[model samples]
Target: MNQADIVIVGAGAAGLMAARELSKEGKKVLILEARGRIGGRIYPLPKEEWGYEAQGGAEFVHGEAPVSKALLKEAGATLTHPTEWWSVRDGPPSKIERLSPHDLQLEEALKKLTGDTTVAQFLDSNFPAGEHDDLRNFVQSWVEGYDAADIHKASALTLRDEMLDQGSWRQMCIREGYGLLLKYLQDACMQNGVEILLHKAVTAITVNQNGVSIQCSDGLIYQTKRVVVTVPLPVLQTLQFTPPLPKKTQAAAKIGFGGVIKIIIRFKTKWWTGPREQPFERLFFMLSKEPVPTWWTQHPEPHTTLTGWLPGPNAEHVKNHSDEEILTLALLSLSRIFNISIEQLREELATFKIVNWIKDPFARGAYSYSTPESKEAVQELHRPVDNKLYFAGEAICEEDANGTAEAALASGLRVAKEIRESF
Candidate 1:
């Protein structure tokens, strides 16, 4: 049987970070990743394919991501900020208003919330139905599209905290792509003698007094003093524990795992910033009521590409659709938004790729969101069972950065500290 001091399941940001930290303390660390490649949801597309390093998965560095920022800096990656934001209803695209009267009222109501509840309940109680329909719709879209959360289950208090933290509306993109940062972490772990085995999907974990035995799908059993599971909540739910961690698995189910369908379309030219009646020269983001409600450009970087974001329930709606069907939907949405012909879009299209995280076997969903019960659920998961089975991931992070890379990195660091303290 293979042996190590600690074995980490999933080589994503959390697992990689944990391995690096534990290896620094002279611990024998082994990281097993189900996927052939590392970086989990942080999939960076080939630079040559799109003339730039386009992202296939996680993109923006939302708000003040201290952990992500520090890692980017260490990786020697440059950060670029998007310039403009626009929205469209029927006519031409226009600049998005930062705050409306309804938004102000919603903000005030959110501040008065004393207890945790679902976003849907909060909206119904405060905003009501008829007069506040716009506000309700906006809130629903924001919750579903931006946070990739379901309004009926997503925590209102958590959303409020996230909104307050994002009051500055600061977002940054890495010039070299997030892959560079992951490479840095992977390299650091390797240099510290942390062994990372790819395509080793962990099937069952048996914990005993002396140590723990991890069984992979390939029939390899690894004996380790401890195991850190950093997979997504959905994947975690499917993992088997020998002693049966009913509470941990049950808690994992309580945490909301959201889906996302990201569509990247590369064009032959920057047609959006063209000699049309109203040019989208400074178009950074565009929102509409189309099937794919959100779209954005690689603004400030002169890239001729538009990324379509269909998240949460919207993505789930088309989860079973084929790639061709999804691509057609994306094109149709863009055509309607730009008042351009679908044929013209086809002609201008250079290359395209669709990323359906909902269908990804290892991921199952994009990331985690907070439910009213998520705080307690996350707490339960954080407490290691028998001091042998520990959990660390974005879902385990019971903070404002629950859905971002920062959260994953922070959780990894926290678990590493916990393991070291135990030793």
Candidate 2:
């Protein structure tokens, strides 16, 4: 048994941020991570030569969050911003149908939910035949990858409110690996004197009037004045809390997080049919499609790679499918869109791989989302217990910027400040 001023469970963005902040203020902080790696979901796939190119966790830098950008810059991580001009692969490059007026209406209606209904309810009432309707399917697909969830289970109001109006920064990907960014954050924490312990899964948390006691799988107990939990929302659903979580927290956990399964495919050559100036970098949104509602390609980077995403229920289905099956689905989708032969794609693509987050025990799901019904759920999760056990993560974010690494960091820092003030 050991004691510290603060204990953080799950060394993801939130935990690391909290530890870094508290440690800098001279608080003894210990971060216990279940996985061998420090970054919870932020682990990089081996290179192209390895089995496949998959991102275990995050892929995008997502907007211009100063906290994330500053951390990356401080760590000397390479970042490249896109130019003003960007193209959307609307129709097949050859036959470009004007962006439809009908589609625009639907888009606007859905976007208005930023302050209104749960995504499920909105789609149910608005879509004539409901969310599964073919017409609404397109919108569902394009948006799924954003939250890594199906539209039916998402929250429209949460999405819209958190939607970064910072126009130009909407679409961007990390030039390197998103995992690299996590590594940088971890390094920053270490430099600030935070101690990170890997493979130490926090199995139990017992809190009393005085403080909190955390128990790991290895039978080690850690005592601390305060505990900050940053595990994914879904993971919390399965955890056994002492004295049982309050009725509200239990219900909030039942809300459950949406699932996202992303497939990253690498090609040997640039086999895009679109013009060089028009190289396919758009979301490649299949507006009304179901299952794999959306897919897209990032220009020829280190390797000509096309990353496809399946969010929500479809993402769950993809996770159940084998790697070869996922690869087949991706190739079939690409062939149909670009009018390319399967043989052509096969020849151009050297290898393809899938990253199944659903199978990942640490991150049962990608990120947390606040459904119209679950809006208050997140706030409930953030409520501290006896000022000893606090929470921070995408699920507990108290802002429109919910379910993002930046939000996670922001939430963690806020909790750290609260603890500092109390001390």
Candidate 3:
């Protein structure tokens, strides 16, 4: 039997941020985390452990997010700019040597739309197929591949809003892995007096006039005054809320999320960059019409690793396949893209790994996306119940920053202020 002024449900970015903010204000905070490790969706893999390749459960800081920038600066993490390369599926694998007029067309299109609608709807309404197939492919691929979203259901308005807010944003990689920031946050929490219990799966949360009662799988009953739930929307749907949050539940159902299957392969040699024999030595990425549509190298790090990403509809097509089968398919896709034999790729392959978010119980999907019907879903999720139950996650972030690390951190900070004001 343990208690605190607040019991945070997850040790994710949002939870850690919330715990730090509240605890700094002299509130006793207890965080229950289902996983043994911290950092939730922001899973960071050590460069040494990952065959010297920089990887994260959710790294890829697409834009210069203020929260991430400040934290990374404080943590002494290095962010490197990645060189852009493009390729399209033609007879012998056509390479897009330079950026085209269609590069930032999505941003341009976003300015034209007046009302909230699905990306697919917006694209269809404005740029019909046949004449706009090139633009269609470019935008659809960017939205679905980058976001892991279903364009048909994903909110065009949210994408536009986020784009509008993005000023001179360039994609970069964190040299020291994303987990370092999490470690800094975790250390901050400890300094501020936050109690964290790892491997404590919260099964039920019952809130009454007295306070909030939390039941953990470890047979511990925690009684707290308030609870800030920072778990993924999918995982939150699994928890048993005593007085079921009808509005939150309804919002969760309406909000759209996408699935991703990221496979990282390591070769004995820097095959793609070295040896004039290889066709794509100068390029850092290869975008193809294969099963794994996106393949990128570990550049500026002197590693021979490539990450294959299967996003959006492509990931869904084979989401149920076994790990071994997925690995085989990745090889096949690469074999076709680089015009190499599968046997050769398998022979050169030193390691094959994947992070499957679709099957993860803690995170049923990769992240949230705005849908045609998700006009107020994020806002509904943000609304606290009785000022005792607070919700915060990337999904519930402001439209301009939703489904991002910045959003998660921002939500945590926002909710902590809300809790403080309520008290």
- Global lDDT of each candidate: 0.89, 0.68, 0.81
* TM-score, structure 2 vs. true: 0.84
Better of 1 and 2 by TM-score: 1
Which stretches in model 1 have alpha-carbon errors above 4 Å?
Answer: 97-102, 167-169
TM-score of each model, in listed order = 0.97, 0.84, 0.92
Tens digit of per-residue lDDT, candidate 2, span 87-156? 1234434322322313555567656554666565676676666444655655455346566655666767
TM-score preference between candidates 1 and 3, better one:
1
lDDT score for residue 271 of model 3: 67
The best-first sequence of candidates by TM-score reads 1, 3, 2
Listed per candidate, the RMSD to the true structure in angstroms reads 1.6, 4.1, 2.6
Sorted on lDDT, best first, the list reads 1, 3, 2
The residue pairs in collision within model 3 are 43-57, 155-370
- Give candidate 3 misplaced runs (Cα > 4 Å): 46-48, 89-109, 161-169, 277-282
The residue pairs found clashing in candidate 2 are: 113-157, 114-157, 137-288, 138-287, 138-288, 149-312, 150-312
